[model samples]
Target chain A: MKWIDAPWIELLRIALEVAATVAFALSGVMMAARKRFDAVGVCVVAFVSAFGGGTLRDLLLDQRPFFWVRHTEFVWGILLLSLAAMLFMRQRHFQPTERAMLLPDAIGLGLFAAVGVDIATAVGMPALIAVMMGVTTGVFGGVLRDVLCNEVPQAFSDHRPYALCAFAGGWADVALRQVEGTVVSPLLACVLITAGLRGLALWRNWELPAWRV
Target chain B: MKWIDAPWIELLRIALEVAATVAFALSGVMMAARKRFDAVGVCVVAFVSAFGGGTLRDLLLDQRPFFWVRHTEFVWGILLLSLAAMLFMRQRHFQPTERAMLLPDAIGLGLFAAVGVDIATAVGMPALIAVMMGVTTGVFGGVLRDVLCNEVPQAFSDHRPYALCAFAGGWADVALRQVEGTVVSPLLACVLITAGLRGLALWRNWELPAWRV
Candidate 1:
């Protein structure tokens, strides 16, 4: 908690947040392009993907002036990014592949998970609920994107350890916070662990057992 | 504004709210059953469809202690209703047709739209935003239901006048609110007009023009 107020930590958190937002927005752009959605649809999807999870977290936590509303730049950034991505992909005849999305998506998941857990813990949420919030913040944007695109959420149905990585990272954050006065930032540790696990899972081709009827 | 504090009006509003929640929950159950989702999926879908729209409205408006959270009974009621619906439908071999869903869904839409508009207006939102809130409250739950079922939202893609009906009803509520000291409740009027228009659309087989590339 003491380390949380450090100037460099705050800067690092903001940078990670921006990177995560861009990553999520890029995933949305790729999905929309693959679906051949119109320009308006593409922008809407990208905005939702970039902001939906944080918005949901804020709502559940009863926070005001949603992150996007508070930071108008996020809205403008997504709009411009969507337009640029659409044009660039179309002009180059670039195929948006799942393989291309893997790295950024994993990075976003970890960063969002760490931020979510911190916020929920700050608000005095129970440990389990905080972890759940972390998973929600990390995974829900993609869920919303898939839902808008008329498909089952890849997080739930892809049979991979996605949200689980966030869950573990949240616990690590919680555990690290318990150590009195350690200089090691829980936020950084959580992000690295979550993203590392996801990257490893992908590289190893790990799979979770799919539900059978 | 004067009539809002009236005891009978409050009672009527509560009754309509309950009816709308039940109707929305029913629609979710039918959809989940149609999709052959398991018991947990059925309950989850029903809960989402019943609560999603109002939750979204509250989030957008920065309302705290969401309506369902304020009333614990709503949560228990949906859980019980889900269980009961599953058993009854299975026992009766009920084939849930789209036709069978129309009446309840329309009633729910109108009621939700009226309530949404009133709440937004009470919160001092401008007329247009209030009307949009009404449409969001009426239509988003069903959108979530369809999204969960892995299909395009009927509100956007069915080419029917679903959200439009809510939009029209919201404006009626807004308009009536402008008239000073009317005994005729705006909530009642909005519900009737919205449901009536939706009913007419179904009977006359009206369709919105499909989007062309």
Candidate 2:
């Protein structure tokens, strides 16, 4: 159950967790706003995008009370953020741009991917399942968000490098875990690999070939 | 865990489970076929619509290994059915219609709603949450299906009595459980209540008032 015994690493994990949550929450808010969802819908979408993946991972691992149920503050945080964003957007006539979401979204994907791998491995899951869980945890929230917004999941249809980046990072994590006396922190390395690849893909307009009938 | 210990009730429950799975799987297949998805996509969508709700409920209840994992036959069955459906549609030039799906979908909704409530109550969850879980299980699959097909959830926007029918049936089950020596079986009563209400709604063209800005 102990992913990190060191105090510094624990603190760092907590910081990264917050960053990931906030980043995803913001992305959710923007998506909801773009769709002109009501305030309640906006909050619901935000909550789903920020927590859906972790919730699924927790359930698969048989964790109790679910994460949002265990930490009600996360729900309240998303609610307030969505409301505030709505008001701010209205006041400034601000039109949310997808570019604004990319950086935070990339960071959150990397952090969550790392966390998912650590949690699955700690639970004694096989390497393949653990890696699948990491990608699922990293990508599922966005899928849920897109679904709620009534869009074909960009992950599936747009042929973007989103899930691919998480998949690569997850394998990198599993590999690092097997290496004895790894020179770098596996979590940090996974995060960098995922975020860096995603950032590079966005900059270079990289795309996976679309599936055809 | 002992939702029904009586031999007859157990047999009925098993039958209902099979019927419900097949019904939802058919609905999923029809939806996917309408979209002209590839065989793999059809199978994935069929599996999601047949199992999505119960999977979420099980996860929230902290049940491990997932229902699908425990019953791999359901997976194989859905896969086979979806493939067969695609072939049949192509050969017959059958345009899958929503009306053709209503009967089985309603029956499956009722059965799954009852099962969801039974499972949640067996876990000692509060009655309200249990009822909520029931409605969620009944309707979430279709929600997932529509989302995957790039449509706003018919449940949310159609203003139909779909989820409300499940809500009412869930309360009926919870209430019947509290009553002593009811003339009818509580499980049977739930199924009748849910299916009857849904059927009536469809027949009468019942609609909920839409929320407007």
Off by over 4 Å in 2: A1-4, A8-12, A15-104, A124-133, A141-153, A164-213, B1-48, B55-96, B121-133, B144-152, B156-213
Model 1 achieves a DockQ score of 0.12
lDDT of 2 by residue, A65-152 (tens): 8767867987888889989989999999999999899999999999999988877877677776677688878888988898889876
What digit string (tens of lDDT, one per residue) describes model 1 on residues B91-203?
78778898899999999999999989988987999999999999999999998888888976778978889999998888888998888475247888899999999999999
DockQ of each: 0.12, 0.14
lDDT of 2 by residue, B98-202 (tens): 899999999999999988887787778899999999888889989888878897788898887999999999999999888845313667778899999999999
**CAPRI-style grade of the A/B interface in model 2:** incorrect
State the iRMSD of every prediction, in order shown: 5.7, 5.3
The C-alpha stretches of model 1 lying farther than 4 A from their native spots are A1-52, A55-111, A121-133, A144-152, A156-213, B1-15, B29-48, B55-96, B125-132, B144-152, B156-184, B196-213
lDDT of 1 by residue, A1-213 (tens): 666678977677678779999999999999998898999999999988988888888879887788888789989999999999988998999999999999999999999998888888777776766776787788889988988898766775565788888888999988887784642478878899999999999999887642222
